[model samples]
Target: MLVDDAVALVPSIPGRRALLGLAGAPAAGKSTLARRLVAGVNDRLGAGTAAYVPMDGFHLSNAQLDRLRLRDRKGAPETFDVDGYVALLGRLRSERTRPVYAPDFDRRLDEPVAAGLVVPAGTALVVTEGNYLADDGPGWGQVRDLLDELWYVETPRRLRERRLLRRHVRGGRTEAEARAFIASSERLNARRVELTRPFCTRVVSPRDP
Candidate 1:
């Protein structure tokens, strides 16, 4: 669906606050679309009408991943604090009288920064984007039930891989290293994300904007 169409539907949802989730494989433009949707909503409605909450913030710390021996598989669903993400979504839904803070992941620091994003009291909609939101595994199963709508962001594999390559290179990896990482890690995660496409409320392409 077109993003403007998606943004227009937010206010009509039957709730004081609505959570719109964007789920997709890495580099599929979920974050980019989430930001655009939030901006579109605020421009059409008003500032503070919508907020963005990213699931990347719930990524396990490098130290934690090292301890768990999952450092090499950073983007995997198992590498995140799924329960923490679930709890934050609950607060964003129920805590309408107070501001809610959520974490954000810094690709430069390669760490999750605490309380990097906030949802103000009375926000009418929250746009959250993540890879595993549609996954039905363990703690991830709770995420779908929390979101009012979950749209899977779809991008051509070639485009996604190209973006991922540039992203990894920008993060300081050599081309060969970036390709290796994608083959060993991101590709596997992308396949896992693909498996959950049938669970999404809709499929949205970044090109739809």
Candidate 2:
């Protein structure tokens, strides 16, 4: 599961204004899977036919979080600019418009980079990957109505932890810190994330997919 594509989800993408959602808990392979799906779909559909706009980029800026007094709570659902994510989805779903610009998350900076992304015209599909794409909050409510399909991915809890720990260490955390962070922040979010499972069109567990 650590090194594989969800081929079941690959065939779901279509050529035209299709909005596909990829949802999963932190470090459960959603980003990796989404990337694979995008590549698979693009290869199948040909050039300029597929694009990716992730929900993570819609996260509030560190400065904005400081202003809101929520700096310590980064990555929690409220830490994101939910309305901004919904707005971007709206733009993609619109008809014959100019190429839509999207924000992207910078792992090195731990911040979102705005207008550093573009969905070229004739791009038939937009794949949005995130932890809470299927959340039922008012901010998240706009998604299901907007997207053509939603998929949820699940990794075994232990595997998820191991992958998350590796990511943290690779991104500059000490092994101890990575383990601690997974035990604390990641697990906390995982429980909250389970609340989103029922909302998806399909649930893709590692073995099943």
Worst 10 residues of 1 by lDDT: 6-15
TM-score of each: 0.95, 0.86
Model 2 weakest lDDT span, ten residues long: 2-11
* Per-residue lDDT of 88 in model 2: 85
Candidate 1 per-residue lDDT over residues 1-209, each given as its tens digit:
45566566565544467889999999999989888888877887788888989999999999999999998899999999999999999988878788999999999998999989889887888989999999999899999999889999999999999999999999989999999999999999999999999999989877665
Q: Give me candidate 1's TM-score against the actual structure.
A: 0.95
Q: Write the per-residue lDDT of candidate 2 for residues 1-209, one digit (tens) a residue.
A: 31123223333434337778888898788777767667766676676666788888988999999999976566778889888888889888764357889999998787899997899867777778888888887687777888878889888889888888877788788999888777767787788788889989888753432
Clashing pairs in 1: none
| Top-lDDT candidate index | 1
